[model samples]
Target: MQEERRVVFIGKIPSRMTRSELRHRFSVFGDIEECTLHFRSEGDNYGFVTYRYAEEAFAAIESGHKLRRPDEQPFDLCFGGRRQFCRRNYADLDSNREDFDPAPVKSKFDSLDFDTLLRQAQRSLRR
Candidate 1:
């Protein structure tokens, strides 16, 4: 069996950087399977770039690739991990369920029972 290629995590990306710009930069190394950009609350951004082959991923790392932006410091690149980045599988949860009935969501206060409303009011008063 062959080793699986992992997604590469590039950190300290600029918020102004576009997805196309990122894709173009990494494409030179190999065929990128998937790419994602994550913007943080602190104003800095980060991203993940996954190559189709392990050899391509290794080439990128050995080359010490960096995202070079005009008038800004180059953003460094590194190997993320073999684990699929930020992806979740919910198929198992859905498959195990026989029924899909979900609880009704109530929006209007008038839809609630009178006794339930009174209890809520009492709880608010205690707070």
Candidate 2:
């Protein structure tokens, strides 16, 4: 069986942090397949960041997975199983709870190739 390439991040998501920031933080280790932050409550929340390779995941685990920005709190990290989660789970799990789930902050640049992006940029300049 293929090993799961995911690491569970246990910590509180700072009010300013977004999924893209979290994903970028892990990219140094390897290519990230997906990064989802489950913002449960105010005190503590959890998220799963899946890498493209088990070795990448292992590297992250070995490094202690300590993420530190100049102005953010460190998250507790560990190897966790690959469990699929959905956005609806938030509502289903607790309807009354107020959770601040930040949307994934990916720019159009992330999806566009350089040529396509350059064309769009030129088009914009022409207008």
Candidate 3:
């Protein structure tokens, strides 16, 4: 199966989190290719994050599905986060974004399979 390596968070991010924090939080799944948070003068804010592998993207989605407090509201997470069409109409909007920069406070991910990670990283570099 060809797993999609992208995810989009629709609506406002919980606690008004910025793209920098978003990157840090999601990086635990894997190396992120890009993370973007766009602001709009009207309507809800949206974020786009792309992971290096399908598994990483899936992990991020799974993490977002966890239980949370009633008062806590997170962006609606979904697969297939392409923004090509959305970008065309965003010239007037102010966007907060980053290209895989893990912010000032680095996020430490839990241990992963080193050999598998290494192989995947190398394959990505080639492609």
Highest TM-score scorer? 1
- What global local distance difference test value does model 3 have? 0.66
Tens digit of per-residue lDDT, candidate 2, span 27-114:
8889888788776556566667778887888777676346666576666677774343432343333345468565788985898899
Best by lDDT: 1
Superposed by TM-score, candidate 1 places the C-alpha of residue 2 at a distance from the truth, in angstroms, of 11
Instruction: Between candidates 2 and 3, name the one with more favorable TM-score.
Output: 2
List the candidates' TM-scores in order: 0.56, 0.54, 0.51
Instruction: Find the number of clashing residue pairs for candidate 3.
Output: 0
Show pairs that collide, candidate 3: none
Cα lDDT for residue 73, candidate 2: 66
lDDT of 3 by residue, 49-124 (tens): 7787877778777785452346656557777554454636434233455443543654343355788778878999
Question: Which parts of model 1 have CA positions greater than 4 angstroms off?
Answer: 1-3, 64-66, 85-127
Error of 3 at 97 (Å): 22
TM-score of 3: 0.51
Residues 1-127 of candidate 1: C-alpha lDDT, one tens digit per residue: 2235546777777888877788888788898888888887786677888888978877776663454756766666678753443366423342336785655776789678999999999999999
Q: Could you tally the backbone clashes for each prediction?
A: 0, 0, 0
Poorest 10 consecutive residues by lDDT, candidate 1: 85-94
CA lDDT scores, all candidates in order: 0.72, 0.68, 0.66
Residue 37 shift from truth in candidate 2, angstroms: 1.2
